[model samples]
Structures are given as C-alpha cells and as structure tokens.
Target: MLFDTHTHLDAPQFDEDRDETIARALEAGVSRMINIGFNRETIPTTMKLAETYDFIYAAVGWHPVDAITMEEGDLEWIASLCSHEKVVAIGEIGLDYHWDTSPKEVQHRVLRSQIGLARELHMPIVIHNRDAHEDIVKILKEEKAHEVGGVMHSFSGSWETAKLCLDMGFHISFGGPITFKNAKQPKEVLAKVPLDRLLIETDSPYLTPHPFRGKRNESAYVKLVAETAAEIRGMSFDELVQITTKNALERFGIS
Candidate 1:
C-alpha cells in the first residue's frame, strides 16, 4: 500500500480529470491521501473532496502567503472544521520567505496561532516551510509545537534543520524534488531520517517527479517519489512503501 500524505487534488489544474487522476492513483497503489486546504477558497472544496472519497482526508489552515487575509473569524472557521471526522491535521501552515505576498510578521503570527490551535485541539500539524528554515524552527519551538508533532511537508532543508524537526518528533516527508539529480541535500536528509519517522508525499499538481518534472503532478506519481526514497534508503520498494504507509496511518491516526 502507498500513502500520499500531502496533495492538492482540488487544484484547478485537475479540473478536467480529477476523478480520473484519483482512479489512476488507486490503480498505482495509493491507498490513502490528504488533500490540503490552505486558504478561504480551497477549504470548502477540500472538504467536499474528503466527504466524497472514503480514501481521501483533509488538512485545513491558512497558508503563509495568504496569512494577511486571515481575519479572527477565519481562525475560528478552521477550528470548527477540526471537529470534522475527515479533517486529520491542521496545516500546510508555516513561514514562506520565498513569497513576499504576506509580510513576515503576519506569517509568523498566523503560524503561531495555528500551532496554538493544533496544540489546544491535540492535533498534529503539517508545516509548509520555504526559505525560512531558521525562523520556522524558532517559531515552532516558541510555540512548543513538539506537543503536537507533525510533518515537515516537502522538506527541503539542510540535515541540521531536519535534525531539529526530528528532535521535535516531526516526520520529514520527501516529495518530487528528491527525485531530481541535483537535489543533493534532500537526498542526504532522507537517508538520515529514522525509518519509523519517514514519510512520502506528492504535493500533487505541483512537485511532479523526474521524467515528469515539467508536467502537472498527480497522486499516481507518488510511486516515483516512493521509488526514489527507497533507493536513497537502500531498501526494497515494497519495504519502503510498507514503512511509509504505516507511518502515515499512525501519524494521522487513520484507521
């Protein structure tokens, strides 16, 4: 079995063939998926997808780039959704220095609030850190995120950063980037993560893996990510899939 622990199947990119793509993923052995809803618009669509598909799950939070748009009521909305049976995590949240759409201060405040909410609700979080490793680690520490340890989605940080997340009981997930030849750091970090804490994802409609790098990504392509991860850890493909699937299930508390 395979689990794409993160994805965005609700993205407009798949508007024409979303069901077909999901069917392909199942055929390729993806037994479970978590669709991320990072803002006001996507959250409802994501919830709809989860409600429609038994194998699909949801993660709702305000994205760092959209942090400026998060009003007080928005936080309450996310909190309300946390009670939904299909909502497994509070995330796709964190700092994103790469995008200047939202001020750094706003991103920090939003991330801190989400972390607090997750901790208060006793739910794991899914972090989306981009080009702000140091600040992300600092905020997560200050917020005491270890109380609700989560996944470092599409982790592209150095081994040192990975080590810190690992110390906080976070799972380091690799995506399409790891399948790239020049992705030396992610490859190295993947090798170092403990097997039990390892996870894999597609970040679908984005980070499409090698041989399909420039095209739109889908959950089926997570097999490519799984194969690359297996190669990095020097384990059989089936073994890696079993470990990561189990890790994903337990991490999300999926039955």
Candidate 2:
C-alpha cells in the first residue's frame, strides 16, 4: 500500500468529482492519504473528509501565505480539533519566502506558535518549506521541535539540509516534483536520504507527476511518485512503497 503523505483534496478543484477521485486512489493502491487543512475554510472540510472516509486523515494548521489572516482563536480552534480521532498532525505549516504573502516576521511568529502548539499537543507536524530553508531550520532548532518530530513535506533541498532535518528527527517526504524530468536537485536529494526516513506524497490538485504534468493531480498519481523514487534509489517499486508507507504511518502515529 502507498501512503500519500500530503494532499489538498479539499481544494475546489476536486469538487466536481471528489468521490471518483478518491475511488481512483483506492483503485490505484493508495490506501492512505493526509489531506491538509491550511486555512480557516479548509479545516472543517478536512475534518469532514477524514470522518467520511476511513482511509483519509487530516493535518490542520495555517499556511504561511495566510499568516496575516490568522487570529488567536484559530490556534485554539486547531488545538481543540487535535483531539479528534481523525486528525493526525499539526501542519502544512512553515515559511514560504517565494510568495512573501505574509511578512517574514509574521510568518516566523505563526510558525513558532504552531510548533509550540504541536509540542503541547504531542502531535507530529507537516512542514512546508519554500525558499526559506535557513530561517525555517533555525526556528525549528530554536523551538526544539525534535520533541515531536514530523515530515518535511515536498522536500526540495540539498542533501546537507536533509541531513540537518534528519538529525533533528524529521522525515524527508517527496512529492510529484521528484518525477519531473528536469528535477535534478530532488533526484539527488532522493538518493541521499536513507530509506527508513523517506516518504512520498502527491500534493494533489497540484505538482502533477511527469506524463501528466499539466493536468489536475490526485492521490492515485502518488504511485508514479513512488515509481520515480524507487528508480532513483535503485530499489524495487514494491519495496519503495512498503518502506515509505511504513515511514508515513510511523511519522503520523497511525496504527
């Protein structure tokens, strides 16, 4: 079985045929997926999806891009939802310098606060790093996030960065980008990560894999990500799937 560790199934893109999309995922052997809740509107929808589908789980938090909109009650709301049986982690959270939609300072503050909340709740976090590696790693270290280590979702960093995150007890997760033809850095990083710390995701409704790059993505396509990862690591596809599925389950504390 494959575990798609990061996805945005609640996004409007799937409204037309969400049920069929989910059915395709199961038919494609993607037995589990973590649907991200990155803002106020999506959190409840994320919970509803998890509650409705036995195989779907949720990771709730605010995205750095929406940092300006986050309020104190939002943190409390996220914390309260952590008690739900289907809520698995505290993220899609981290810094995003590429967009700079939120001021760097505000992003930093929100990121730290959520990290603290995750620590308090004893839940793993799913991080989203984009062109802000140095500060993200620094904040994670300063915050001592190793206490409840999590996955660095859709990792696209150097092996050195991966080593640092691994040292800090974070699992390295790869998404559809790993399957792109021109994705040299992700391919190199894929080889360097230990199999035990490797994971796979689709980031669906986005980052579609090769041969389907411009189309809408879905959890079913996670198998393509796994196939590419396996080829890069020179392992059998089944072996890669098994290892990553195990890693995902353990990272999210899933049985």
RMSD of each: 0.5, 0.7
Worst 10 residues of 2 by lDDT: 173-182
Clashing pairs in 2: none
List clashing residue pairs in candidate 1: none
**Candidate 2 per-residue lDDT over residues 120-139, each given as its tens digit:** 99999999999998998999
Give per-model TM-scores.
Answer: 0.99, 0.99
Cα-lDDT of candidate 2: 0.94
What would the per-residue lDDT of candidate 1 be over residues 1-255, giving only the tens digit for each residue?
899999999999999999999999999999999999999999999999999999999999999999999997998999999999999999899999987899999999999999999999999999999999999999999999999999999999999999999999899999999999999999999999999999999999999999999999999999999999999999999999999999999999999
Q: Runs in model 2 with CA error above 4 Å?
A: none
In candidate 1, which residue ranges exceed 4 Å CA deviation?
Answer: none
